[model samples]
Target: MELLYEEAGQPCFGLPSALATAYGGDLGFTTPCLYANFVTSIDGVVALGPEYPSSGSAISGREPADRFVMGLLRACADAVLIGAGTLRATPGHLWTPDHVCPQAAPDFAELRKKLGRAAQPQLVVVTASGDVPTEHPAVQSGATMATTANGARHLEGRLPAACTVFVAGERPVLRMTDVLAALHAHGHTTVLTEGGPHLIGSLISESLLDELFLTTSPVLAGRTDTARPGLIEGFELLPNRQAWTDLISARRRGSYLFLRYRLRSSCGLGLGLSAACRKRCPT
Candidate 1:
């Protein structure tokens, strides 16, 4: 079925349903994976400035398609994960709140019944310093904080009762892989990584992302050196082994284009197999 969003005498379809279909199996299960969502303009502008504006003239030039994709993606995620820095910079109701949309929110109650306990997918904050403002709405609503050893130590006495701070790394910044693994361990498998660019780049560099959902607006900021840089520096993927991604779907909404790409298997030999071959066929 095609879903559409309307604005300014224009009707735009929701993100391609095919993108959602690609993640049909084992999304919120024990898969250590994440999907990245990005909104950019046709001219390749993600935002007008360094700091995103909350509303009004700031977003006037942006297309309605971008806004629709953002809301839909959040609604579909098991849990929304953001860097502490992004939370601090722009903190509010991240995912429309569970109480606001009983039907739209993931069936935590059903999950609880199956698991024999209330299993709400946690809102995770990745922080190096554990310095998130205690009064932030997310903190108040019991968002979990994941940090490095030093970060937990720094906020040892400051975190709220509901927040779970995991010291998964010794350094100040927790590795992206470690953080995702911990989330998977906690049963939050369908993760969404909304960004501040640096975090997105880090995840891409680590090869931890399984899919990318992008909304392209029709406007162009035209400035390359804005306050907030583009989500990606360029179009090229990081070089290592052969990286493969397949375009799942695309839809036009208002003045934006929503696209999704799924990461496929990479081409490479495993270390264990290579070692066994060398031992058996050594000259």
Candidate 2:
């Protein structure tokens, strides 16, 4: 991978110069940056599913560059966020940076230690229904489950002791602001979401996403009537005049392209800007 464009930021990792060259530079995040990563086909299909397994890898052709970027971003996050559906879709998946690219595990761990972060980024699962697979490998190992009050009842004792369930919403719908507040309280300000469309839509709709890292694969997963979702789902954005963002950087490897965008206005007045989101965030 090589740098095609960069607005200006020195993201450093402790890897050897030759190994780190593909990533452009060492990467880090602001105190409170909520970014997302996705790999979509040229035709814009993020998954090859309603039923396909590990759909993202299929769409991405298991591209090494994509994995490198994913691992790098995960290494920088304080928490890895994902929706329940994403949890169910990849049964063997673990959200850790090392899991994506084990060869770079040492570098990832070194980067985290250098950044003053935990040994591993916390895994945060968001669900309105609390329908996450309790026995799934990721769940069993433990994760922070964010859901509605009603959903909490469904998850009560199903999860392992390592897991903690927090009610992020008072109503039927889950609120992203409350979720972020809970994460922030736990010292998790830099968030990285690996979504399944609906979750991305919810975050984007609420203006809670700070940045986006997208990998555009060379192939196409042509959509059909069977609900092959795009980068965002659940709500319409461009049609609703959602806030626009600016491209901050771009890179390319093989036939794939990695791009980054910074939202003009990011979520919840950022980390330390305000303690109460309601006072500054748009309703």
RMSD of 2: 4.9
lDDT by residue (1-283, candidate 1, tens digit) is: 1333211211122223332332221122113347777766555554455365532124334344454445445544566787776676664655432433343334434433343333444678888887888777778768888887878888787877877788765666678777877776776766777765667767766666666777665565566455545666423465754567777556664454666766553112111111122212111
- In model 1, which range of ten residues has the least summed lDDT? 266-275
TM-score of 1: 0.68
Candidate 2 C-alpha lDDT tens digits along 47-132? 77758878998988888889988998898889999998999899899999889899888878877887788999999999888888
* Backbone clash count for every predicted candidate, in the order shown: 5, 5
- The runs of at least 3 residues in candidate 2 whose Cα sits more than 4 Å from the true structure, single-residue gaps closed, are 9-19, 267-283
The global C-alpha lDDT for each of the candidates, from Candidate 1 onward, is 0.56, 0.82
Q: After superposition, how far is residue 55 of candidate 1 from its true place, in Å?
A: 8.1
**Distance from true location, Cα of 83 in model 2, Å:** 0.3
| Clashing pairs for predicted structure model 1, backbone only | 40-217, 41-217, 42-217, 50-227, 50-228
Instruction: State the local distance difference test value for candidate 2.
Output: 0.82
> Candidate 2: lDDT of 250?
87
TM-score of each: 0.68, 0.91
